[model samples]
Target: MRADAARNVDAVLRTGARLLAEDPAAGMGAIAAEAGVDRRTVYRRFPSREALLAAVFQAKLDSAQRVLDEARLVEAPVAVALHRYVEGIVPVSRDWPVDVRRMMRADPAASVRREEQSGRLDRFVQRAADEGLLRADVPVAWARATLDHLVDTAAHGFPLIDPPQAADLVVDILLNGVGRR
Candidate 1:
């Protein structure tokens, strides 16, 4: 594709993602109009709404994966890595908000990428457990599940908080729980 064509495609995908996040039923005409592209252009690039949505979902996943990679979760101390990862991902999750279940079913490549990220996260949790950051009684799987839950909740619920503060809150809650103690 030419430079201008690529830019148009990017604009359409970005607009489609934002629109679909706000309304899953958003049409290609709306995406094209929002993207300042002709409806024919959108149709040429994406034959159907499902195709456009799949592209948007894949783009979102690719972006989130890039953020995770930049976080260097495997290189940092588990505590630090957890905070960095959460901070990096919060905005991606907030902006995309794709229907994860539908994405997994509709896009195999996305599902594979998600599994790869899950495996990386599992390794991080295992390292934390090994370093005694997590309770001895807690199984690694349980810890991994808990961490995933905490991050997802923070991503979905704490959009108003500053990214760094949201990361801090999530880590604090995960490590200390909510009880006054």
Candidate 2:
């Protein structure tokens, strides 16, 4: 695709994510208007709203995979990996705020991709425990869940804190509880 076309697609997908997130029933014309693209462009690229939504979800997954690849979860030190993952993912999470579970329900392919992502995170969390970054006694599921919640909190709850600082806060909270030490 040409540079301008790619830019238009990116704008459409991003605007679609934001508008659809705010209102799932948002129309293609509205999205195009918000994205500053022609409605024909949106319709040309995505025959239907569902297709556009699927594309948006795929964009989120692609971004997530990129973050995981960059974080080097398997090779990096657990603490370092955790911080990198959080820092990279917070913005991705915020940028593509679509719910993975909902996407999974709508598209089986998305479900598989999400499961793969979850599996990798699970392994990393388990590694963290094995490496003494997390308590061995804590169930891996619980730890992963807490980590997920923390990332979500960092992404959505702390609007003022930048991603890097949010990552630091998340890592600290995950490693050491909010309870008085």
Candidate 3:
């Protein structure tokens, strides 16, 4: 596609994502109006609401995967990688809060991507355990789940705090817990 066409597509997808997050019932017309594109343009790019939603969802996933890849989770020190991952994902979760549950159920490709990301995270948790960052007695799966919970919490709550502060808080809670030592 041409530069302007690509820009329009990006605008539409971004507008669609924001609108859907605010109201799942938001339609293409609203998204187009918000994006300053014609409704026909959106229709041309995505035949149905589901198609647009899927594209928006896919774009978020792709961005998240890129963040994880950039963090070098498998190669970096576990502590560093954990912080980096949380920091990287904050914007993705905050900006694209699409109804991921519904998308995962409705889109097969999304389901596969979710599993792929989960597998990577599980491996990263295992590595942390092997590095003695996580207690040996704790199951890797459990640790992974905890890490996911922490990241999600940070992502959801980031608007209340600075991104770096939120990332630090998440890492601190994950590594040190809430109890006074």
State which candidate has the highest TM-score.
2
In model 3, the runs with Cα more than 4 Å from the true position are none
Report how far off residue 156 is in candidate 3 (Å).
Answer: 2.2
Comparing 1 and 3 by TM-score, which wins? Answer: 3
Task: Please list the C-alpha lDDT of all candidates, in the order they appear.
Answer: 0.83, 0.92, 0.86
Identify the runs in model 1 with alpha carbons over 4 angstroms from their true place: 1-7
Model 2: lDDT of residue 69: 92
| Ranked candidates, highest lDDT first | 2, 3, 1
| lDDT per residue as tens, model 2, 57-176 | 999999999999999999988878889999999999989988887899998999999999999998999888888887777898999999999999889888677989998988998998
Clashing pairs in 1: none
TM-scores across all candidates?
0.85, 0.97, 0.91
Compute the lDDT for candidate 2: 0.92
- Residue-wise C-alpha lDDT for candidate 3, range 104-178, written one tens digit per residue: 888999989987987898888888888888777778888777877777787775577766777798888877778
